[model samples]
Target chain A: MANKHYAMVIDLNTCVGCNACMAACAMENQTPVWKNSWRTYVHDLEIDPGTDHQVRRRFFPRLCNHCDNPPCMSVCPTGATHKLDNGIVLVDDELCMGCRACSMACPYDARFDVSYNDVEQGKEFYGELHHRTRPGVDKCSFCAHRVMKGLKPACVETCVGSARLFGDLNDPDDKVAKLVKTGVAKPLMAHLGTRPNVYYISEIERAR
Target chain B: MEGMFYSTQNVWTWWIAIYLFLGGLGAAAVVVSCLTNMYIKTHKELVLWGNISAFVMLSVGSLFLFVHLLDHLAVIHVLNPFGLLTKPDAWIMWGTQFIVWMMVFSMIYTLPYMLETPFWRDMPLVGTILGWFGWLGKLSLSFHKVVGWLAIINGVGTVLYTGLLLQSFPAVALWHNPGVPLLFIISAFSTAMAFLLLVLHLAIKREEDHDIKVLYERTDVILISIELLIIFVFFHFTTYGLESARHTADILWNDMGWIVGFIGFGLIVPFLIEFRGVTKGWNSATPVVLAAILVLCGGYLLRHYFMYAGSYERPYPAINSIHSQSNYNLLIE
Candidate 1:
């Protein structure tokens, strides 16, 4: 009833496995400098067990699934974590009890602990005296803050190929909706029932 | 290998191990104080309910964590939970706070009831307020969620959070398997049972009627049976998956599964001792001691595995190795 469903369409056909999307996400969100992946590429299969995995690997970058029934949301003791009407789960960093329950509840390892920069730490101070902190969990928000400002996500705009599409699936007339109407997309880790917003359109299975 | 793919219980294992041990300790402390309340029980022969419970709960719970944490703190760089989120042990910040609060509160609550007498009627009131706050500590048990929705958030949150910690981890494939949370819920029930037995033993001036004692012990028996089953199934999954799955757990244990600890002196042995006490009807100080020891040890073992197996793990090889294995390229190439 709350216009909460979100949809993402990723065209595997055009994706050249470039990591522009991940970089864009990191920079746009001002993610912690030392944090690993804010978003990542998952694959339909594990890499072929070989020494040349990176070169042969078909990139399946992934972000949060924004499930309709997030286990993390239900288990929040302080109500610090919640799913928005748009189906994304966001944490109130200010209110978080600093408990790791939601991080634990996430089936996809979607929650990560990162100490957000107190102020926008410019690139000059990229790596420096790091401090241990009572960390909170972070995940992709579909770049919601940017979307409301009437701009495409940095990742979507920077894509060399128009491979990533973000829009309201609820608007049947929207482009993402049209693509979803025809594109056979799959959510990574669908078996876990997180129902991620990012979807992949693939036609063939490659070597693992 | 054992808990691979799943993540919730990895955290839950830690929460349960810590909380379960702490929870037992809290209950045990109450029992010990109850025994000390000589004013309430006039007929020593009537039956010692409260004091017995307190000692059992305290001794057993303390036994479980005391030795293990001594070992862990010696090596870990534990950061205070109040700090920002940069620390690896940040998740533990809230958990440790909860454990500390609960232990203190349990002591406070037990003291008033254990020492309740005509001379000091108001002493229990001080404990009551603290008890309320301590109960509030239960909400903090989940650590990830903040304190928002309502006053009751922490207690209910602890239950679910504790459940997830054990079942959510990745390498504890079996612990995070389908039945672990169910087991933890049962563990809470068992902890409650252990708590009650300590109550029975600590009766001060009067002895509990034989019938009420029977009820509590029977409940413990049934719950233990259910708990043992849960543990059995959990082990079944871990051992089987460990044998077949990928990852370090396949080796019977990696450095991380040290949560299992040294063979005879390890956590499982403590559990076995309790199990033996349960079967032999060693319900007095012995069962309480055994249960407290085992459950607490079990809880620590749970956390130890998660720390050892998942999260804050060493980085992937500096060189990307995803494609070298046949498993990587087809998925990637």
Candidate 2:
């Protein structure tokens, strides 16, 4: 809702998910390579038996959709989870109670529990020092820190396919808006009440 | 068949469901026990003991609910208790509110008794009223959205959360189903009965009353019947549908012999002894203890299998399942 609302439109028709985007994101954000990164790829979906299992795998790279009406925010007993007008659901690092309630309410399984964790000394995690900072939640921030300085998402910038497109949807003339007007696109889980902002192109066999 | 939508519940869902069941069970049990205090001495002791369980249920229950609900919304927000009748989402919001109040009333009514204060014990009617009020409040949360509207608020929450709680992982297929709500409610009922029997035996023994021992023993037969039916449906129904679900059934049949020991030997044995006690017109704790332990084991194992078995990836039969899909673009955060 600021200068422009950002949204992602995935072109499933042209995507050759080479894991380049994931690595770029981790490097740019200094995120650890552990399971709880800001982004993840839920690939290897084998829907049917064919020539072999290798060919059946379908990649589904994911990050938070930064939905318009997120359920995760409403169920927080404390004011720890906050959704900005710009469509970002933020977990205030300081106020989280380490309660796993929001994780359950999330239909998308977006909330990750950083709990029961112990810090190990001298462990170089993703080129950064690994240390437990207490238990809480973590997920993609849509690169807010980078967005403040005026730049595209690190993944979009480094993408080889130009398959991932991001732009202001509020503007009719914007790139994302133009793509939306013309291309066949889909969202991951459309049935759940949460109105996800991310869009996809081409027919996707999503888990209804 | 096309893939349908579903969820994989994890630890968070479990926390919420357990909280709801404990509160609902504790509240409902107290209401029954407290209300019948005048007619039966066993009921009086039950009313007194229900206080501790009520506290345990309410305290731990609300903790998990709040943890999930708070983060789902941002900042400071409170449910418009009035909108519960209008909006579907309002159901959960309101159900949670009702549970909290019931917790409050029960705690307030029982504190003096817990502390052995003459004030609360002297006014038994007030205590009874509190228990009734708590029961109504807790019961409201259990209403399904059909009559209640939108989604299953408290009851379905208590039930399906158990399923989703187990289903979130791929290991347990039995717990993962659209049929989860029904299964959970049945299991919860059976488990509650198992606990009730144990508690009732104690309450009755304390009163030195043998008249109702036969009734308690009869109830065990009913509980056993219900539990077996539940288990049968859970295994047989799922086994016939999906192949992956069948594997889960196999896991239960093959490796869950300990489950029989727990449910049959432990629970059934006590139930039988209690039955014998009734026929002889005597009181016995041995049967009650055995049944309680067995029922508890059954409940825990039921959930455990679902969690572990749900994680197994099943091979789906399909033509050209190995078709190399073209790499597609995805939304970057």
List, in the given order, the native-contact fraction of each candidate: 0.03, 0.02
Q: Write the per-residue lDDT of candidate 2 for residues B91-171, one digit (tens) a residue.
A: 244455555455555454444344343444346785565445565444433541122222113333433344444333322
What's the residue-level lDDT of B227 in candidate 2?
58
State the lDDT at B300 in candidate 1: 49
Poorest stretch of ten by lDDT in candidate 1 chain A: A115-124
lDDT of 1 by residue, B1-333 (tens): 211221112233443455454443343333322332333333222212433343344445434433433122321222243332443222233333444344444333333323333333345684455455554444433431222122122223333334555454432344356575565555554555455554455532124444444454555556556766665564456555443222424333444345345223233454455555546656456555555445545544644453434321111211111112232222122
The chain A TM-scores for the candidates, taken one by one, are: 0.76, 0.79
Q: Tell me each candidate's TM-score.
A: 0.60, 0.62
The global C-alpha lDDT for each of the candidates, from Candidate 1 onward, is 0.48, 0.52
